[model samples]
Target: MATVRVQQADFDIGAEVAAVTAGRTDIGGTGCFIGTVRETADGRPITAMTLEHYPGMTERAMAAIAEQAEARWSLLGCTLIHRVGRLTPGANIVLVLAAAPHRQAALEATAFLIDWLKTRAPFWKKEHFADGAEAWVAARVEDDAAAARWGGGTAGRDRRTMAPGGSG
Candidate 1:
């Protein structure tokens, strides 16, 4: 089963990796992706970022994405952790781990998870700029393109058009 968590607390990468690999000799490779709050976005200096999501809906979407990755690849295990609330630059925002019997499967699954999460998950972000201005983050075309590469039309949909309770 895949472990999916949506929390306000930070996650320990080492512990997460260990938990996925513990007593699992069949796992050969584990692809990991840790996303951190960057100091800048599109050349604008950022002080902090706040992420918000609907509790039940967000977890369900993440779990579904994880399941999709597992079904598409030969994954032995997977872990996805996304942080909410306020976050400063350099703070961890999300983590993804996909373990498989082969490196290719693990790597591809990791990529797919992150890409889909960026578009599919119903997470709203607000950026605090260095000048004390705050603005809601907009969805990027690049993210949609990345997710579309996985061959799903739903992945390319604009998140802004999604209904309040719908997953993009």
Candidate 2:
């Protein structure tokens, strides 16, 4: 079983990793990734970014991502915590930790979880510039490509996936 959390409160990286690996004697390796608000992008400083998410769908989507990771790898344990609402620069935004007997599975599972979350989760981001301007973050084609890797191309496409010419 895996744990998934979507909330306004931020998560503690050490605590989450501890909880994920607790009582797991079989786990020989753990891979952890924490995504935080960055001060700059490319090279320019980012003033702020507001993150929004659908209530029910956000949790469900994250759970499904975790489930897929477990199914695709020999995972002993995993934890995903995502923060919502207003957040400041340098704050923790999300955490993903995967525990397994080997490093490969742990690493791959972590990537799969974040990639799927970025593409499929209902979260939206709005970047606010230093001059007091805001814009809704658009879903990048690169993110979709990342998710497709774990999705195994068209064979594993879901309802969220609609062909370019198909009505969405």
- lDDT to native, each model: 0.92, 0.80
- Tell me the TM-score of model 1: 0.92
Top lDDT hit: 1
lDDT of 2 by residue, 28-96 (tens): 888888989887654556688788888998888788778888888978898988888877789889999
Clashes of each: 0, 0
Candidate 1 lDDT by residue in tens digits, 1-168: 899999999999999999999998999999999999999988999999999998898898999899999999969999999999999999999999999999999999999999999988889999999999999997787988898899877543345545677654
Cα error of candidate 1 at position 29, Å: 0.3
Show the lowest summed lDDT stretch of 10 residues, model 2.
152-161
Off by over 4 Å in 2: 41-44, 154-168
